[model samples]
Target: MTSLPEDPSSPIGESARDTAVRRLQEAFSEGHISHEELDGRLHWALTAKTHGELVAALAALPAEKAGTTSTIAAAGGQIRRRGAWQVPRTLKVASAFGRVRLDLSRAVIEHPVIDIELQLGTGRAHITVPRDAIVDLEGLHTGWKDLRYKTRRSSRPGGPTIRISGMVGFGRLKVRHARR
Candidate 1:
């Protein structure tokens, strides 16, 4: 996935209804929705004033799946896997416009690379990595704020490579790399 350009300008102060209408119009223009469907949903979203109402309206939109499939397994939004002998393992993660939690504290791999593509809305996320592993990061992009990284030690040889890219609306991302 490609990174979205950051917009440093101030956010629009329109009401939820207005915002919904604007989003619907943009979606239609972008060919994400048909005219009749856009009209129906735009009416509902525009009339939604409360947070729950707006969420409901937005939830009616089409569903899109993110992330990748490899030796690792992901189900019900949780990822789990075990490495086998005589095989090099890799893990890839991706999330679009939602919250994603990654717990790599129990991972056991000779060599691993974690690639994450995030498109967050307003929710925050936390990512933890092994300290003894080497982490090489690349392709990190965000729309609302700068990507944040916190690590204790520097990268070492034969360690893991963590790549992140995508868009964020209003939220903070914290990544902690610690030794095992």
Candidate 2:
């Protein structure tokens, strides 16, 4: 652990803690640790008061593997990806004047967190996430129509988090969780 101030709320310390927490979640999703272990490590990482404690929470975990991003775009037509497709760690979807549909109910997801950047200019974008997944839209910007998302209290809490970002100009973005 790099020597730093002992305050956990400091800028550097907070960033380090966030990274450690993400790594722990990734390790859990990658099957490197059990759910119980993940819970314990996550607690340690979240409540760490010092950089040394933060580093200890990530002990024995290997560095995160680098992954490529996949992009699907359409200038004036529709874009769709369904069935048992393989999901990359990062994805970019853009549509200029048509519909966009992404169904991830049966996709092969290996990452603990997936980042999807959507750029839709004048159409609707629909996303069907897995039942246990968490969707984050904090970075998304919309216009004219509000985003549609139905939140549920998931029984299983350790699934991958799907983060949707980017902008949607003059269109609607609908997001729903899978039934199964």
Candidate 3:
């Protein structure tokens, strides 16, 4: 059995490989690339001779953006929704490793319109909303396995509800919702 190369940077290499795979999986999930293309990229990444080469290969992949707006406000690693709710704006979120949970139960919306868009790179994510709040959700996991989601409906007209739960193994998830 031929063992994988082991160097002082083995751990880093592994980490980099994992990251690259996750990004590639995300791209594939988002329909940015075909399965064959993703497989080819993964093969190249795994066969990369140096860390720099691996990094370059990963960087070559396309990135996922959540919002349609050009102005991005990212604060404290958390991008809180801002401005008046009228035109039904979109909220885009992207993260890796740590979980990104959106609890909109406490949010007070004066306007009658809003929207949300979520993007995950890896790890776990949970999102909650009011039952009365109009929502549409979708998720895709293009890794070695499938992504998961758990949702619960509420009895209250505006009771806090959720389209919760998503787990990604070297992958990503995106959710888009519109409120009226």
| Top-lDDT candidate index | 2
TM per prediction? 0.43, 0.67, 0.35
Model 2, total clashes: 0
lDDT of each: 0.53, 0.87, 0.49
Model 3 agreement with the true structure over 97-169: per-residue lDDT tens digits: 5555565644554323344444445544555454466443443334543544334343335432222222355
Ranking by TM-score: 2, 1, 3
Residue lDDT tens for model 2, 35-148: 999999999989887766776788899776765489998898899999999999989999999999999989999877898999999999999999999999999999878999
1 versus 2: better lDDT goes to: 2
Residue pair clashes in candidate 3: none
**In model 2, where do residues sit more than 4 Å from their true spots?**
1-64
Q: Which stretches of candidate 1 lie over 4 Å from their true place?
A: 1-98
Ranking by lDDT: 2, 1, 3
Which of the predicted structures, 2 or 3, would earn the higher lDDT when compared with the native?
2
